[model samples]
Target chain A: MVGAGHAGLAMSRCLAVRGIDHVVLERGEVANSWRTERWDSLRLLTPNWQSRLPGFGYEGDDPDGFRDMTQTVAFLQRYAEVISAPVETRTTVTSIRRDDEDYLVTTDRGEWRARSVVLASGACNLANVPKVADALPDGIASVHSFDYRNPDQLPAGGVLVVGASATGTQLGYEIHKSGRPVTLAVGEHIRVPRTYRGRDLMWWMDNAGVHDERWDEMDDINRARRVPSFQLTGTDDGSTLDLNAVTDIGVALVGRFAGLVDGKAQFSGSLLNQCALSDLKMNRLLNSFDEWAAEVGADADVEPSHRLDSTRVPEKPPLTLKLAEAGIGTVLWCTGYRPDLSWLEVDVLDRKGRICHEGGVTSSPGLYLMGMQFLRRRKSALIDGAADDADDLSEHLAAYLDG
Target chain B: MSEATVNNGVNADALVAAREALTEAPQAAQFNWRASCEWKNGTHSHSTVEGFFGLGEEQKRSKTFAFDADHPEIFASEDLGATPVEYVLVGLASCLTAGVAAIAQYRDIQLKSVKATIEGDMDIQGILGIDDEVRNGFDGIKVTYEIDADAGRDDIEALVAQSQKRSAVYDIVTNPTAVTVEVK
Candidate 1:
């Protein structure tokens, strides 16, 4: 397996349980991404209680709380020890190609031959910035969410955050709170309250089986996989962090970042419609939870269901902004991430560079993928979700080897 | 289940098959639409559309379609026909409305009626060379849909949202596109 992150480690536990001999290769330390890529204030979106893997779960006192990056790294490190995973840290795989009946993994440290290989390196290895980024003027400093650590690392001026997913909203909120004027470029995003009806929103999703929705059951699996992360934040009080939340705190809200034209940052005029869409979808999700609660007779136990206020949209959102003139020294692209599979020498990638896979099984025989959005289930990328996917993929890998 | 399979005047199965086929043969999906325009008078032009290239071959419509574009009288020009911007609004509305119908049919939601109203706000300062800061195009565009369908309010809203998500002209207007103009 490639990578020693949660996905790789979880799969290792599953393989060990199944009596399969395998080694996990890590480019850095275990949970390397959590140790480096995450922002300073970043925390796991899922609550602590849900942090679980195969035969391993979070035993901390703050079950209802979210784990910060440090806590998350420590948790995963403990998991690696508890599972006694055969993890080779600081070993980076340079290439993986088919070598006759077996596969050859050429790493910087050395090389190894295996009957099968699992790619759990991760989905967010590289930031997927748009081509329009090249049009920005020379004055502004551009930073992707992966390299962004804190507001202090940015120049002292206004910040224009592009995108409204979980990363964008959180960074926008945090940067705005740090005494910097922020303008958030909104787009189509999933909105969910942090807490609903006296319980965490994730609790509702878990109980309602929203996260367990399998890929095959979806009407459009491609769309489901491309769906953006929910506009949410992990806070001590579990308070919501949506567009309205940031707007309430004096952060200017704009439309989607359309392009940079004539040195001016052009924004889309679909702000109201995008907000309306997100509001509608959020209410629809809440309504489903309410119906589920009523059907299961669980409504009497929890607080009464209520709807969140609609996303507040400005009557006249700014269509363009002159970055330098507006004192906007930084343009943070919190758009999204893509898997970095440049080293894979196999011809299994699709036109979009994504591995063609059904669940975790790739089109190339005996090659598997893990930790991708909606890989097998809706929660396939969540911290608590790795075990279930690992369990299923490990079985498939074993079968492929036997066959 | 049987009633759900009822066709709502749309060949959704054929569309799905075409989409799958085009996914495997993306070259066939490379379509080039064409329109020719002739200057009639001051700010008035005649445009014709009849043929387009798609499915890896040149294709023609059953009949030629023509349109007249002119500035309104407020711009000190002839009010011979609708303005060019108005045609853009028409394109966006028609494309989105068609998407709504197609998606509704595919989802098995019988539609009773669908109406769309589109408006674009343009600042003429840029076109008049009065202000370089102002853009030559619409400052913003708004589209509203009123529909009576078999589905609920949320489902209808989803139809409009999905329509916008897939509309070609909506993307063209919302995002920047490259255009080249030259004289032979």
Candidate 2:
């Protein structure tokens, strides 16, 4: 066990059940990512009912409700206690190397010689701030979504939130609602309704067998994996926050945050296209739902609303808030995240710096990965996906150890 | 930044006098206003509505405003100024904007700009008498605000909430009122 997050703890349980001895190393407390990397008002995109561990599922009062970061953290803490995972907290892994057949995992505390190693911390370790961030002037305070807590932490004045992913949209809406003039830079993303036909869309997706989709079956697995997360929000009522809703809340919509040229933020003029793309995708999904509902005899007759017209704003947003004006005091970067594999001395990284692996089994024998997006199934990277992923990885590891 | 200055687009002097009058003589605050319009052809109407500046005995002849309105093409009329439903939206937006400006001034925050987008969804089935199931009024209304001011998001949200709570039009729309019609 390498991480103490959902992936690590779940893997530990699988190993323990198989009577295999292993110690989980965590850089911080259990579910450290959930504790540190989430915003104040953050809620799981997946409903509480889907927040299931290997042996423990959600047994809370609000199973249909989405769990906020605080509730999620507490759930993980309880899960850790229930599983009794052998975890070493505050031990950061300094290096991991393959010594002949055995793996040498070194941490700040000490080193361990094991027959197999599982990199279970998963992706989303490093904030994927673009190079354009460097061009932004020092006068403006910039913080990635990972470090952002709330609007109160931001400086007064206008805000330019880069990236229209779930995090960006939510933050932009929150900040705009807080009364600051906000300009949200739109980008490519999967658009899905928060709810359809009185049921959470996740519930329907799960039932429709979307998460069980295997990579081999996908026409373009790489492209599918690269598709950004949905423009969905997790709230008590499960209200859908599309680009229209965001714009309706008074946040200025703009194209991709191309870069800061000559000390001004540059934006592309493809906002209308982005909105059209989102609208098309959302309608396709809804039409699919309609077909599914008919086939299943489900009482659902929700007509799709008009596509949110992006051409409404003609005036190209000030190409750049001249840094000299000092009007925009903060530039929030919510441009997603990537994995941090610097500690691994093993030659498993590909050209893109991504770990070279197939279905949790790396090219290097005795090395495996868990909690990776599209490792085997679409759900392979989610909390619910950990059980099966750990089971498969542990089975392979057990066989290798026996061999 | 004088306390008595009309910095927020609200006449501070007039507001102060009204507040004092309302406090001293509560009955003086009770004034009935009306909006009457004669229907032209189709859904067009020419309205010369009464303005709100006048109240009590000191008031001279009521100041009147004129505006022409027509239904949209879908509703079988030329797209004139704004439809009746649109006027409701306009009234709501203006009233809320006023409240925001007043709150901003009261808080001494500099308001640079404020714009509102008010939209109401309606099913034509009700108005067209195609179906009895549908209601006559808008099914739902959404009011979105874009405001630039030297204040925090929370401050602005609070200001908008305050405006909504204090707005008479908002109350009228939200709460049902009693109306009796009789032939004289």
lDDT of 1 by residue, A258-366 (tens): 8898779988877877888898889889999999999999998789989899899999988889899999999999999998999999989889788899998987788
Best by DockQ: 1
Once fitted onto the true fold, the runs of candidate 2 whose alpha carbons sit more than 4 angstroms away are A299-326, B1-184
lDDT score at residue B117, model 1, on the 0-100 scale: 98
Error of 2 at A274 (Å): 1.4
DockQ numbers for every candidate? Answer: 0.65, 0.01
The native-contact fraction of candidate 1 is 0.55
Listed in order, each prediction's TM-score against the native is 0.96, 0.66
- Regions of candidate 1 where Cα sits further than 4 Å from its true position: B1-8, B71-78, B121-136
Error of 2 at A306 (Å): 10
After TM-score superposition, the amount by which residue B163's alpha carbon in candidate 2 deviates from its true location, in angstroms, is 48
Please give the distance, in angstroms, between residue A96's alpha carbon in candidate 2 and its true position after superposition: 0.5
* Native contacts conserved, per model: 0.55, 0.00
